[model samples]
Target chain A: MKVTWSRRHVLETDDWSREEIEHVLDTANGMLEVLSRPIRRAPPLRGRTVILFFAEASTRTRVSFELAAKALSADVVNITATGSSVEKGESLLDTARTLEALGGDVLVIRHGSSGAPYFVAQRVGAAVINAGDGAHAHPTQGLLDAYTLRAKLGDLAGKRIVVVGDVLHSRVARSDINALVPLGARVTLSGPPTLLPAAWRCGDLPSGVGYEPDVDRALDGADGVIALRLQRERQEAGLLPSIREYARTWGLTEPRVATMRPGAPVMHPGPMNEGVEIDAAVAHGARSLIEEQVTNGVAVRMALLYLLIAGGEPRLIVGAEPPTSIAGGEPPATPLPTGVV
Target chain B: MTTFDRRALEAAGYLVVPGFIDLHVHLREPGFEDSETIASGARAALRGGFTTVCAMPNTEPAIDSPGLIAELVARAKAANAARVLPVATITRGRKGKELADLVELAAAGAVAFSDDGSPVDDARLFRSALEYARAADRPVLEHPQDLALSARGVMHEGRVSADLGLPGIPAAAEEAAIARDLALAKLSGARLHLQHVSTARSVELVRRAKADGLAVTCEVTPHHLALTDAWVAGDRTVAWEGRPSPRATPFDASTKVNPPLRTEGDVRALWDALADGTIDAIATDHAPHASVKKDVEYDLAAFGISGLETALPLLLGGVDAGWAALDTVIAALTTGPARVLGIDVPDDDWTVVDRAATWIVTAAGLASKGKNTPLLGRELRGRVVMSVVGGDVRYEGDLRAAPLAVR
Candidate 1:
């Protein structure tokens, strides 16, 4: 199907509609086939430049975006705060302009400030993707998580998904709710009151989301479970008493997993504390989709890079046979070499 | 004045009122000239209809000594725009450690004593400062905020901050500090003035203190009365009323200010307080920050708005909206602030405002060097046509010109 994608930035999923989200997921499915192949490459974004500007440290997200850009044959340059001009206090706008001037078609930014990506997006002409911006949003992760869930359990409509732990600080959880609620999913957030603020239930969160302090009640008959990483800083900040206490009370153990539907997938946006937020068994268990979430992250990012940079056009090799199930399972009728793509 | 000019002024329904007195303004001179100088801030004040302004002493090295106060007086005299009343720091260097020579500073022309950017966190030191300020015969202006509660928060702690995932400054930060200051004021019997009272409970606290016969006064900012924290959510429409349309993106650092714009409920309470005389004055905090300071991330951006030029129009808009009685709003700007500072403002020093005029607030149009205001593109009602300070025409915009071009 020919998709006329007009959006230049994927800063947040808050304003994305159900159709827009499904379109991204559909595009991601095609990218997954490319990832599954031996060649594992596409020519859609060939000669294009993708700048991974991570002001905050992130191994998973940064690498995932790098792999996504490389898979689409785009030149990827990684810029981190520690070594770059950011260390000399170059403003986000200046850094973005510098990269854009060097022919960066897309700027994937991860910043410690909540609205840093939005700050850059407003100033630059490049397609901006929010890799994660301080407690504010991780839209691509939200999309990938949704992609993983939808791949496992078809049609998320009215599906019960419980997101447990650190919802207050989790841009992942906020974006998940932003992405899920529009796709007809009931998102219940469960954690300690310090991490999962009461305001989430009444504040401007999407309508289909709720807060459940009781982890068991929150997990009860849930279709899927997403466990968030519990940062040690939260304890130092007096938000949590102790790591041991957090594990004893709110940790996702085998018993808690059993409360949900049998075989319901457990997921975490990782660098996980195995014994704290989730047990080692559940993390490595048959029900865990954490690893798949990471893999799907690449595909979701590729879909975004393609849709935003390539403008939703499938630009495969000139004379090669169209890979089955690529580009939403329908090959372009005419394989035109559009230089713009 | 010529008969034609008077008739034109009359035809335009201009109201000549007492020159506005801003009790709280940051003339970021002495140190941060990149943001504002006494000359520019005074000119901006004159453009806004303020003939006299209390220049807050949160400058580099702060106006803590008699020498600095005299220097500020000299600079204001040279500026020749608005009367700049220098407020001396309560603590030497505003360190909140040792007290400044309040008597000497006051005698040098310090109208009030304050460390306006920060609260005097130590209760003992604050109480001592109040006692000393009483001897100096100047009100101790408190920038009410408990740094502990307001730790690292960029905006008001409410539904908006919660939704945005930004840290919030709870209303308790202001109230807790106010409670401590009120207790100290009662103990010292010194006149205490609260700066930029934003929360509803703060208004109530000052109201009860005034009823209990404590010498307490507070000033509210126009941004607080007219705008809410919703402005931070990137909806200009949210400054007035209603929920932001779905298209509202987050983060405009221009809306970032210390004692962040609060909820709509707080705005309503402030309006009610302003009308009921619970709120003593409407002082433009008039904090000016360099564009570089505000052109970055929301968390990193400096907390201020270049408010000197926008104050009159914003308060006038409030009057037009029937938020407060016209007389109440005018008094809050003029006589109320005069009473707060205990100054006999000259009757001849007045401002001619075209009440029917409307002008859009633009950065280039502002006389102040700081162009960081949330009201940047907004068309505000009422414009100051001319301002006379000490019977001298300090600022004279074309009175008969079209409103849009007058500024």
Candidate 2:
């Protein structure tokens, strides 16, 4: 009668709660302080050995985690999960056990199945952090996105944000769903009908997420914008006529970004398709946090590393609110939950 | 010279068998009139040649208290042609969480205690019931089912149901309960009587338990012994609607019973249990329901068919027709069940089974309150000429007038 769930086991946003979202965001603020310092790093994962297991091709995240580990002075092992003994029928469970046997402390996995990380983490007794999996989740990218927005807008509650582009195939969309919903911002998933799983209900997601098919409808109540990457690997064979046809219907140009709630930030999850996805003018535009997100990525990874390893001491807390301890153990803050003082 | 000693004449082609016993039957009372009543049903039982019957605890008010048991016993005494022994519920209700007043119920002449239609789910409560039964020196007739496993399920889960688009009720639901109950019995030292043991494997468990000296016994319904899932299908809309289905459909309001029917192999296995003494007895499970209530779809059908008048004839007819031997047949109906209930049956009962005497049974001519007679219009082989309850004639049949003897 009892079952447990962990990691990016689900394919959409509403998986993370608002309180949990805020906790991660609070942790992110601690990360920002680590950035402003001259040392740029500290021992977060001191005695821990972290293994970055990525079977998918990677770019920013792969480097960010390794550098994050190096900055924290933890031993690190990077292994591609494909074409190993696993292809010879080694279960995800057996491989995880083998890795744990080798003294691997944490498994940071990115794979092609939506719940692969969850499966691996559950099979062996290990703490798992999802990197990216099958158009499902990129938790680190989601943290960087929130860390960027929180830096500018102060607190995210009542903030307006719109995510654009081929969100239908972005693992970052799944992560953003978890991040944005609880950060106190409203989210609408806008994409073609074919991209939607029929069973998906906006309420069924974690706290603050929703789905919509119309871009104009999304822009109507928008705050900030997050444009996701198009994974050509996700396209059904011959389902789409051509790249031009996809661009005409679903692409996000600068003009589209201009229609958001005024002063709302624009963001992307990197490896952008240039003029085809979002016009070049907007990619390098002044209103964009695209570069700040990567810088925030290393900072967030450092923050995550510090909290996960050395456990950061609370510093001169800034515009950020206190950690919302909704962890069943804490007493309700106001005799009941209300906005943080 | 002898105008013919009908009772003694009845003793020849067959043995002067004592009245057969049925440990389960539902004489739906307190309100449901269209279905059945103790009066007409007992008359049917008399005609069926059962000298004694054990009434189920599931009724209008439910037989959970001494007052309800007394009420049913009163109605049964006034109505019965046979001795009626009603099993009282083991809880203030058959809710199964709390133990009922076992000592009080046993004092009120309850043949046994059971929560039959519903299984007691909570393990601690069931163990408590078993302990209570042990202390009271009575038996707990368990309705074998783990509700969670058998949720919203209808037919036995197998190939037939898959093809018919029927929901599967896995054998595990029943077997799981049986296994747990036997273990509980082992711990409590109480006797356990398994109700409607349909599968061969279930009989094997009881046999093993008996060999190991655990006080365990089981009963199989006539329907489970005789019907199968093939009855669920039909040729060109019921050309193969099955021999039991048509007659059952009329009174079928009461035709639906739980542990719904198993497969053909299970039926054969039940017969095998009868032959090998694996099954201790045959119970009509004579669940009666009104005709109006049966008009619903098979999925929602009430579970009974009139068996008061059919139990003896069916088993005896089945024997005469080569479906079973009379020795195996009589043992299931008489001493096999009597011993399960701890009754000391005398030796000279079967001398009254007159095989030559004919039975004129037809649904058109029955007096049962249930209109859903599954055997209507089918001519079965044997009939009870009369019942001798306590050395007295409780029932007698009219002689068939011959052309010359008509004068």
Among these predicted structures, which one has the highest lDDT?
A: 1
Best by TM-score: 1
Model 2 over residues A163-232: C-alpha lDDT tens digits?
6655544668767766765777777766665454322322334345666667667866477778776656
Per-residue lDDT for B1-407 in model 2, tens only?
Answer: 12324454543444456677888877777666557788877766777777788888777777878888888889887874667888888776778768889888988888788877889888778888889887777888888998987776556655444333344577788888899999998998888899988887787787888889998889987777655655543211111123433322111223245787777667767777787877888988787777555544444456556776766655664555456677788888888888878877743332244444455556556766765655555555556656766666666654342111100
**Per-residue lDDT of A48 in model 2:** 67
What's the residue-level lDDT of B242 in candidate 2? 34
Model 1 CA lDDT for position B218: 94
How do the residues B1-407 of candidate 1 rate in per-residue lDDT, one tens digit apiece? Answer: 32224445555567778899999999998999999999999999999999999999999869999988888899999989999999999999999999999999989889999999999999999999999999989999999999999999999987778778898898999999999999999999999999999999999999999999999999999989888888898866534444454334579899999899998889889988899888889998999988888888999999988888888878876776677788999999999998888988776788888776778888899999989998887777788888888778889886656443322
Model 1 reaches what TM-score against the true structure? Answer: 0.94
Q: Candidate 2 chain A, which ten residues in sequence have the lowest lDDT sum?
A: A1-10
For model 2, what TM-score is found for chain B?
Answer: 0.87
